[model samples]
Target: MLRYYGVDLLDHHRGTLSARRVWVLLKHLPRDSAFARELHGEESAWGLGEHLLASVIDHLAIGNWLFTSAHTAEGESPPDPPVPVPRPGVADEEDETPAASAGEQDLAWFFADL
Candidate 1:
């Protein structure tokens, strides 16, 4: 069933598989039947718990994606990326005050001793 939907378990575990695709496949799982039993295997199987957990995670991801997609589908543009705030006492390029020098600096001074 998973393979039919291009969901490789390894890729899913690594988060490389698409959650929407997995959700589509999972939602179509047979309901309460011998075939479903055979597909998922015996309830006593050691891997059944892992499979169930994966399904739950996929559903959550899909739900979040759908929620965001719904807003865009309704003619709303996605929010813009956040703009960076200037540090205090820093001067803008157009101002007469000297702008901070551009270079890599050691950040160890910013932290307190553990």
Candidate 2:
């Protein structure tokens, strides 16, 4: 692979032969920015470091292993059904939606525009 790229991958980093290369090498890879970045871990793994393992999964396109385009909720609820009963001596408060931060609201609007 380095020969094709006109550089020795071994020399790219010194004293490292473990070769933490991502899966799905140049084979059948389209020359698209998204595909390249996903393989390179640029905008992936939530920007956390130590993502060499994740880059492999992203390159392989494994549905269960890679990130999906599904709408997933991060919060978890109680396993049992809710028991609608107020606590003793508790007063009913007015319901109100939490105010989102400006950054959060801006990101939401940006994605909505996209």
Candidate 3:
């Protein structure tokens, strides 16, 4: 069953920083190790709850940027390099935001097309 869910990405700094800290923590601690378990319970330190931590770990791993040996007791495998996810991408020029309407006369608006 999926464990982590409902992670708040609001308060941009806190959320993103917390995720980065967790990633670093995972790099040092083996998955499901005692240290990880302790930190997961201590929400203040990790800045996330149990489910949120699990969700963050899952997303990073799915993107192949994080690895965990939690599934096995031996911790036999080494961490794998991140694998790029195949994405349906749009050309940058095509994806640009539509230019502002002509009536807006702000400096940014004047430069919008440029």
Candidate 4:
């Protein structure tokens, strides 16, 4: 059976690459390879600098797509996974009613002009 994955670019300002190229690069990530060097080498080609490239790698690492290490050159292991960020509009488990779903609160405003 074949498997497929998807990558959505939320931040359009970062970089650009053909879909094929992106796929090819991500294909190497599973092996726990040294991706930082490859990214740094192709930084110019990808139209991103060290900081931006690191950000991309960090995002992938945080998303669990790839493992990364700051001291990989010295044979250190991949760092711990980054903390997951909460998405906007996602209510915490404890919050019974989020701001958007504030029941009956907006009804007063709705009938104010009526």
Pick the lDDT winner: 1
lDDT tens digits, residue span 1-114, model 4: 012234443222255545445545445443223332233332213323545666776687665634345435566566666754443334568776433333235334533443
RMSD of 2: 20.1
Per-residue accuracy of model 2 over 1-114 as CA lDDT, tens digit each = 453444354542554432333122333334333444344333322333335555554555544323343334457332332233322222457645333334433334423422
Question: Against the true structure, candidate 2 has what lDDT?
Answer: 0.38
Which of the predicted structures, 3 or 4, would earn the higher TM-score when compared with the native? 4
- Candidate 2, backbone clash total: 0
Give Cα distance to truth, residue 64, candidate 2, Å. 40
Ranking by TM-score: 1, 4, 3, 2
TM-score of 1: 0.25
Best of the two (1, 2) by TM-score: 1
Q: Give me the runs in candidate 3 sitting further than 4 Å from their true place.
A: 1-48, 65-114
Candidate 3, 1-114: lDDT as tens digits: 012323343423455635454344434654355444443432223323655666666678665543344453474674665443322221244486434332223223423433
lDDT of 1 at 100: 41
Each prediction's whole-model lDDT (CA): 0.49, 0.38, 0.42, 0.43
Score candidate 3 by TM-score against the native.
0.16
Q: What TM-score would every model get versus the actual structure?
A: 0.25, 0.14, 0.16, 0.24
Of the candidates numbered 2 and 3, which has the greater TM-score value? 3
